[model samples]
Target: MQLPDPSSTRHPGPAPYLRIATEEAFAPPEMLEIYRRILSGANVDPGFRGLMGFYMSSPSERAQHIMRCLTDMDALRLKHMDDCGVDMQVLALTSPGVQVMDKATAVSFARIANDYLADAIRRHPTRFAGMIAVAPQDPQAAAKEIERGVSQLGMNAVVINSHTQGEYLSDTKFWDIFAAAEAHDAPIYLHPNSLPPGMYEPFMEAGLDGAIYGFGVETGLHALRIITAGVFDRFPKLRLILGHMGEALPFWAYRLDYMHRATVKSQRYDSVKPLRRQPSDYLRENVYITNSGVAWEPAIKFSQDFLGADRVLYAMDYPYQHAVDEVIALDGMTMSPEHKKRFFQTNAETVFKIPPR
Candidate 1:
């Protein structure tokens, strides 16, 4: 099949990065309808303008708005791949996963979401792959869903929001879900959703909130909690993915490392093993970062330097950022061709087990 030409248009640089993140494409119709209603003044919430402004000002706004119908999954995958110069995309259900629902409801939604995603991959094997959306609210059910998604659906990995409703992933109750993920050898993509209650009040007070502040703060803390909890020590082979430039973690790696190293009392957690290594070490070894909403040269280079090029992947954070602009931004960077290739494609392939084209 003939894929779309990425270089057809004249741009400042090589075509921007081809996005593979979940939110851009997998936004369920129901979610978009809710967003539309909110945007159209139906809800008129106090935070509506801030939310819309962020969405409109994102670098990949055009790509982010394209929602796929459940029945047209194959066409959507092909069209997205062609338009974005994406050779293969690892799919996952959009935000919050099935975590918000009760145990039974979460299990049902997860089966439906995974089945739908698997069907998309089945219809276009070379163009798409999938991640299981499990409900962390119930560990047993979450494990079952992970097993089903990986064994039956053939999903490559799992995608989860930083926290479920209000609970962070560090809780012991969620260990079964992690164990299943580790057993299946599927990485978990840690994307951010809304902040838990009271968490964003400080940002709200400053009038700089939502994705600009809240999302990063919330997700960063979540990632840190996993590191501090020594979850990686327990599941050393488990790979975790962070979107939007590691959700601000990369920029603060040095400080985090220093703080962790300099304070002895702080190092004493309830875990069996001590955090002998810096937080950045775990980030480099066990975690992967993506260039989603962030496209600046300095930020990308800094993240690559800290996490290594092999740990970075390209993401557009679609609907929130424009894919075209993201590609344009990366193309303009002065990074080596090999590094760029890894960021655009190879790293994701390795992490998600996507067969190379």
Candidate 2:
């Protein structure tokens, strides 16, 4: 999988409207050090060991370049955005961000990272918007941090890097985080992390534990778990943003609805609880999907058609999987000017509450 070089293509100048790229990621410098320390310690997550171990230690040009881009919230990132004609980027702390740390470390680092991002946004108000990073390791403290982020820091959304340790957000222990998100009306961007242990070893053995195929599998499962667990029924107003084309959920909507109904009716598993609506209903009504790392026109169009036009948005998946040519490809996608506007700009504005430029 060769990545596009932003330097290879000429900028297309301006577009019909502001181009806001959601799902962009940045890391505080110290976060890298923390990851390094974790990699050297015992009881390391196998998925993290596979993903970050490679990125943090590999000397390949791609690894080095991505590492450089990840820590830079300033010039280099801005340059790529400018070169790609992206008007704004909605930044979130990079994956496994403080999630693998202990409760005390996770809580404290989450606040520090949020403050770091808030300051960056303050400096580049028009260029950057941010999502709140919270530690689900301590849901109560996390809920308070979410409030502080939205109320005091002017952040637009909450970013949960899929799971904590090996636990998904569907568990009741993590509901406080959802409660906070719903109370503030802040969308939770359920970004992918490396797969959790037990389920991750096989994928890692095959070298599929990163973004290639494992991420969608892991994150899509997390989204479905929330739906099947009646999280939506519990907090009907909660909004979720799933990247990588809703982790391929739109394509499987009908199957999910059908199978979920069958499973619930049979009570096959104690956890297979009934819901007020079908699984896909929650997707249509409560979730938003982004074309992050997915540059194909047919897939993007299908996602919009299947999930409703307004529920689809654009994201660069910056630093990790971005290219100027990919931006050009998206620009040339066949859609009505109005729908295109929603896909590239307005949908993100609405979902993330991004202010107009």
Candidate 3:
């Protein structure tokens, strides 16, 4: 059951770049308990019920292995990072986070999780940086927590596991969270979760309701929702970090800009509003993406070329899809050393405001 010790397999001597994994995940034990409780309760999203039901009690070895990695914030996690040549992991509270809880519970759990993350960062300042977890169930409270996380707890950013109870951030009720993020200059990392109810059935029937396809579909849709809703225009200073390569947005630049313009012009969808810039312009201007699960050079390079080299950063998607060969593959990408440094190191620093090592 032991994960491979990649230290012996890593390339010898000093690496030319630092690997700051931006989409890495960790969860406090209490959060997992919340998930367990939700499984037996009503009003739970079916997809979440399925996903956690499997993870919590599945006899599958992979599930157990991932559980160990997800719950560990100290020695085991650090050992995995060292083994894989990851210099640092920008830790985030894992998917669904406090978003799955009721308002009161969500708010309280967020505070607890934020403090836990703050402690982890303090314990290993160089090896770890964190994104604040907040419950979007209560946007005002979420905003307050973001302020506290950034100004007081030293969190690098905020992590929202997309869609709170099937409600996307595009809703104006959630704008307070955006306002807080903008004021603090803290980037919001939009991580993925299982599809919500109403949209979960078809995907689940096909067994695609988890990472294979659903996560990207759900999160990409959420990102586009925010873009077309004019959240970026309203909060121009806000920066959004999307892992899995901008949730495939960079790849669809021409289509998004064209369709968005067409939709707005035709007034086909009354919800589509006029934007100050093209949909893709916002991607270039206000968004940064991480190459998390994707290790393919062509996709990574295309995202960089399309979004500008500065916009794409490196990530290991640790404990979930962390593989030594992925790191080697990214290391071998066809790019200048300067670009590589930015890909693996500087871009994360610039986006997350990580201090120089």
How high is each candidate's TM-score?
0.81, 0.97, 0.96
What's the TM for model 1? 0.81
Task: Report the lDDT tens digits of candidate 2 across residue range 235-333.
Answer: 999999999999999899999988988888888899998789998899999999999998888888898888899999999998898688888878877
Which residue pairs clash within candidate 2? none
Order the candidates by lDDT, highest first: 2, 3, 1
Each prediction's RMSD to truth: 6.0, 1.7, 2.9
Candidate models: Cα lDDT each: 0.70, 0.90, 0.88
Which candidate leads in lDDT? Answer: 2
C-alpha RMSD of candidate 2 = 1.7
- Score residue 34 of candidate 3 by CA lDDT: 85
Determine the backbone clash count of candidate 1.
11
lDDT of 3 by residue, 7-117 (tens): 436642358888899999998999998888888887677878888778889888788988999999899999888767899999998888988889999999999999998
Off by over 4 Å in 1: 1-25, 30-81, 205-207, 266-273
